[model samples]
Target: MRELTESETRVLFEKLSKYIGRNITDLIDRPDEPFCFRLQKDRVYYVSEKLAKLASNVSRDNLLSLGVCMGKFTKSGKFNLHITALDILAQYALWLKPSGEMSYLYGNHVLKAHIQKMSEDCPQHQGVIICSANDQPMGFAVSARAAVECKTLEPTAIVGYHQADLGEYLRGEETLA
Candidate 1:
């Protein structure tokens, strides 16, 4: 995966910093120095002493698992899922390994084009899917089942910028099931 350009990195940091204001201190467990930040419920939570202590003990492998698990849990029972991660290209391997039902729309072109087409094709049902920048379709069968089980047929849309790490495609499978 390509490293983010300096400008892109700066943009990411700026956005993160804006959300970390005031709570910046909470991210550091030790008063003298600190490392790492926590994300919770679409919000970045500054780690307090207690939380930091727990984070410190977590291993790298465990941390990766935790991240995937968190992503899965956050997605719970949604009929249609849309994820848009800035670092998707770099983190695809670790991010898309969880077990669950989901539909990941990756890449700006595919996502945008698909959404536009879906919009033009199905205009009646709207506001069904919520988009995010950090979701990936992992399990093909599971996602198909979820999509079929979903009561609402409202079209959903997502926007991403990379195509390499989007995982498997299960579009028509849902309708067949």
Candidate 2:
């Protein structure tokens, strides 16, 4: 990812703050230095550290990736948000029903009946921070339909897939660390 210009960084932060309902320009732009990085023309990554003094460009394969705390990148350049980084802006979260939570936590898409709650604030098909009925954030999901139509969704209809989940921590991999 390449370092963004000051103007470019401010623009991005403004857009994100609107979506999450807060002016969080300072959240991604540290007081001491910058925290935003351009992953391409349309996508960007936000880390917790100030790396501009060390380097300007950091790609996915670079070892410097260790400094990346979290990020929001575009998907097909349609919208800017990566499903995994949902926790940072989780205030406008979607709370799923128990059944729906189970389906999603296991890597399956969420169904209509599984949706216990969600904010009417979200637009249709937008990436959302998802949580279980208990308020535990499961991960991210693309809204299958708008709030008005969510109730009418078929039980078998898939809402959205998990962009990230805690279950993966115990998957086939074997590690003691």
Candidate 3:
């Protein structure tokens, strides 16, 4: 594990804080000369160094940076959330029913009927993270309607579209050409 310097940690925290919409650096981490987090077997979750790198880029470029590995959840059950640090911080989340989970994971948009719940994170048409009922972050999505208006939407209405669903591994079925 690489121990980050004070400035490095501060820079990382600031960048993430802005994207996540929360000042929660200390909640998940501690400030030290060399700040680092070791994922313990007993721990349920932890963010990866890749997140910091991505955040740095977003911070430097002032854009929405998409990362491949944001964070992970341990089956050990130390925590209940299996989401990327970025999504967790963004505050907008959508919980989908089992049927929706299948469709979303298979690269389809979630309809209102398939949705189990939605978080009051961002305004309508804003970006939101879609998760399974288990609280596992599945992918990024854009809210089809405002937070308050989402509930009034029809069951078959489009709730959000899957932008990233960690389907790269499942996409490796191509044979050498």
Candidate 4:
């Protein structure tokens, strides 16, 4: 594991900013403690400065991973978010109806019929956290329509595009482990 290069940080921040917006500052400069991002293999880990310092003592060959596995960099350089980062990215969310939870867990995109509520100011084509009506985050998605547009759309209209979900824990257990 090593520090991210300047270009790598830029790419990762750009992607994260899309989902979390200004909240990126909260991740980097926490009130409790200092934290940082580290690169291990192709994965980026959100680790604390203290923990990272301790982890650095271990040999690279034996250190499999560090703190939270935020995401990974694709071979082409685009950053792909892992489901593990959902907690940190749970600021803006779209609440789904109880009946629609199963479909999203099955990796299906959220339809207009599934939406129970959402941030009123939510705009179209923006990243949003998909949550259960009870306020549990299910995963990440891109809004298919603006908050106002959903009110006029048919039940079958797409509301959010699925990105990553809890189902991936079962589907990609090997990689996650």
On a 0 to 100 scale, what is the lDDT of residue 158 in model 1? 28
- Please, what is the TM-score per model? 0.22, 0.59, 0.53, 0.91
lDDT of each: 0.29, 0.62, 0.55, 0.90
Instruction: Choose the strongest candidate by lDDT.
Output: 4
- Over all chains combined, what TM-score does candidate 4 have? 0.91
What TM-score number comes out for model 3? 0.53
Worst 10 residues of 4 by lDDT: 168-177
Candidate 3, residue 156: the lDDT equals 82
Q: 1-177 in candidate 2: lDDT tens per residue?
A: 466667666666655654464637555566776555544444565564555434445444563443433454355323445444556666667888777776777877777777787776566766667887787777766677777777677778766555656566655358736
Candidate that would win on TM-score: 4
Q: Assess candidate 1 and give its TM-score to the true structure.
A: 0.22
Cα lDDT tens digits for candidate 1, 1-177:
112345543443443332232332343355655543344333223333344566657664454322221121134322222232222112212122111113343222222223221112122212122223344322111111122222343323222223322332344346654
Flag the better candidate by lDDT, 1 or 4.
4
Residue-wise C-alpha lDDT for candidate 4, range 22-90, written one tens digit per residue: 778899999999899999989999999999999989988899999999999999999999888887777
- Candidate 2 vs candidate 4: the lDDT winner is 4
lDDT computed for candidate 3: 0.55
What are the root-mean-square deviations of the candidates from the true structure over C-alphas?
A: 15.2, 6.0, 11.6, 2.0
RMSD of 3: 11.6
Cα deviation in Å at residue 43, candidate 1? 19
